[model samples]
Target chain A: MLDAVIIVLRETLEASLLVSFLFVYSNHFSVNKKWMFLALVSGIAFAVLVALQLSEISDLYDGTGQEVLFITVLLALSLLIQWINFIVIMPNYLKSNQQLLKILFSSIIVLAISLEGAEIIVFFQSSLANDNHFHANLLGSILGLGIGISAGAVSYYLLNQLANTGVIICLFLLVVVSAGMASQAVSYLMQADFIESGYPVWNTNTLIDERSVIGQLLYALIGYEATPSFTQVIVYFSYVLIPSASFIYFKIFSVRKN
Target chain B: MVLSKTGSSVKAKRLFLIHLTMLVIGIFSVDASAKRLTIEIEIKNHFFIPDKIEIPANTKIKLIVHNRDSSSEEFESYELNREKLIMGERKANIFIGPLAAGEYPFFGEFNQKTAQGWIIVK
Candidate 1:
């Protein structure tokens, strides 16, 4: 429930931000509100339909297909987080108010929100996999969604209040955290044998069990692995640490004027 | 901000009423026949119409399980000791006892993906 809530909140907030930004932009250009709302609703509806389609597809292939789908989603999510970091999050640190950047952010936000809707479907389907009470599960999901939307609204309001400097720093940090967790999730799917094998670097399960609460939290947040294959660890580090260090370095030294 | 204008107040009120009416309709429709519980089970591509279910205690339910997929699904709850084999575009009926309020899990034995649902006797 908590995991679902967090994912929903993050995804919804990203979508809300995009929509609000578009509203503001539309006002500047005097775009038709009716058309704008229609487009937005259609996008959301499409996302929901895709999610339902994926759930149905998962049910067709036996358990193996579902496992493969999970792996694919994790990989896609990881790549998306990285792409967002490289495109929107990083460039913001170097310049202010670039029109192209704004357009890119808006587009990415729409894409992310639509995909997030699909992810929500997957999450709910998985939750119901073990149980069959449609009413109960539906009630719980509705409650979760309500909370998520509230959180998203609050986060958007908060983001608007923060100073530009703070927003920049916080946004960058958020991207780093999201990227780290995404990378770890992908590595986990790979290790689970849902995906084809990559090289194994080391095994450190003896030192720390990944199943422990603290260990799992670390793994979710920072891509910590006690026993990771060589390629997994390298991929994790390269995706997170390298870009993170470079981002910090560039922010502090290279882009001093901005 | 433009929506806050006086002229738009009427439009806003109308919109609010429409939304309210829809909400009320949705809620009331759900409670239409208290005894005739209209439960909807989603049949997706690869999974059971419903993976799990919960019910109120001692309630007679008209279990409306719909398999919206091409593949057939079976709804079986071991605790309830009941199984309903529902084929594609079909539904099965099982008159459950006045079960006590608790969690009873069910699933599809053949297609584990499509076979799962539960009854909550609350």
Candidate 2:
């Protein structure tokens, strides 16, 4: 039961950070919250399908199917995050263009929930099985899930409270997380043997243990890895560079035009 | 040679694009031709069979993990940097390699106390 709690908590903390970030962004723009509802329903549907078909998924691509699925999803999610960065940089983003941004945010929510929700569904499927420990396992899962959602709700309000700095803060989080997810996509590619992963350039495990709770939360928010390969680091920084350059370009040129 | 501001900016942008392309290609040099060594690990009752594995350093290897348990388990290793959930009575493949010579510990997250092992890259 304790292990169940830990597992869900880890997955949820990782997922909810991004969800809250997107929620804040959508709120700032006054885009319809319908995306949140649509995302939840579709995402859970997709997750249930994935969990049910996992055996087939495990066998695909000569047993590399799981990695392939993760790579596709992570890359798609990363692309969605990158789009958010672009929208944030647009000088007129706040006052207009809510419709397309609405779709983008909705897609982000769908992908995020689909990715994390599958694990929860799989875990719960086992927990709900007939056994004496069923009650304990179910309780643990509910408790863990509650903690995760509560943390996300608290963060949403806190970021909204920042008011003036909210957009910048959200944008910065998006940039950092998107870059990290890009690196994760490449790692998945490497895991599938679709690409090679050179030995890690550095190991920071001594400084921040990856197994610790703090390490888990940092990973959720920033894509933190104690040991990162050369390809992963390069991919991460390249993502960072593109968005920063776009923000700077818009800031300078938009001001000049004004 | 002196040029207009637009010409200089255009040249710089072109240079940047070319370098970016090179960097991308350099990073993703997929080697379909290289054969990979395959290793098998069995998980029975939340324990890694052959709890210690040895492999050559700096070589990619395919790890076939078969879960023989009646319950699901997650194969996680921070040192080798991997996490995969293999449902009960199922199997999965994880690729890890070109690692520096060292002992990387791994465990089943669902049963961490009993499910433990090590990969010794030499």
Candidate 3:
């Protein structure tokens, strides 16, 4: 139940952030109200279509196909997220008090619908798979989404007050969280066999079983595996390390040069 | 520097038309190519089949997932923003992007041991 809530919250929060960004952008740009409404409707419709399609497609395959499908979706999502980070989020983070409202509106329709929509659909499927009640999952998802959106909006407003100091901190935190999420996603795919050669690097399950509460929390936050395979360990370390190293390099060298 | 005002206005009009045409074409192509790619996924006795996949760039895929086991499973990928719930002996479909070349991974939220897969776009 708790896990379900977290899943829902995370998914919904992303969607809410997109929507909030759109709202602010539209208002700042003074875009025609009709066009803004059209964009919102389009985004919602697109999300529904994607969600329906996912459920329908999941019905088609039996074993290997299913695994492949899951991996494919995860990879696609990860890429999309990276794109957003590079294109939208990062730009906003780097600038100081420069309202990116115009840029935000440019791709708001597509980005808002696709990313958030997909997240919600995935959360529902995962919760249901975990033996959760349908009603409970639905409720949790809606609640989480609400909270997430509220948090994002509030945070955005707060950052405006604290200026660059708050913005930089939040941006850094977001990067770390996103990296963690990316690693976990990759690990899950490796375990699924949709990817090849993911052997355990070492079997630490004997030392600390992942079934415990602490183990589960570690798994949730840091992509911890008690008996991590060779591929899993390599992927996790590379995912975190490569990005962190790049970030450090950019901070120490690139920024200083500028 | 020597151009007449009428000639310059005509040139401007032509440029605007070209820009408009390009925008229209871009929108049309994106819409036309949004077709979903279908992939078949399996679950048996509570395990995922194949467990990993590599997708090339610019392919939109639809996953057809079937659950043969008595228990339900969820195929989830945060990166792809995709998830599908399969009840025991039931099937479902999840449509994912015209993904660029990269890696996106997923798994079964419930039967973690059995359901796992990856989208590798090259």
Q: Among these predicted structures, which one has the highest lDDT?
A: 2
By lDDT, the candidates rank as 2, 3, 1
On lDDT, the stronger of 1 and 2 is 2
lDDT value, residue A75 of candidate 3: 50
Please, what are the lDDT tens digits per residue for candidate 2 over residues A96-117?
A: 7788888888888888888888
Model 3 over residues A3-29: C-alpha lDDT tens digits?
A: 456666655555455444444433433
Residues forming the 10-long window of minimal summed lDDT in candidate 1 chain A: A191-200
The native-contact fractions of the candidates, in order shown, are 0.00, 0.54, 0.06
Using Cα atoms, each model's DockQ against the true complex is 0.01, 0.38, 0.05
- TM for every model, in the order presented, reads 0.45, 0.88, 0.48
Tens-place lDDT digits, model 1, residues A113-168: 55556655544554555354445545656765786566445644555455464355
Q: Assess candidate 1 and give its TM-score to the true structure.
A: 0.45
CAPRI tier for the interface of model 3: incorrect
Per-residue alpha-carbon lDDT of candidate 3 for residues B4-41, written as tens digits (9 for 90 to 100):
99999999999999999999999789667654456887
The candidate with the higher lDDT, 1 or 3, is 3
Backbone clashes in each candidate structure, one number apiece? 41, 0, 57
Model 3 TM-score relative to the real fold: 0.48
What CAPRI grade goes to candidate 1? incorrect
Model 3, residue A191: displacement in angstroms?
A: 4.8
Off by over 4 Å in 2: A93-96, A128-135, B1-33
DockQ of 3: 0.05
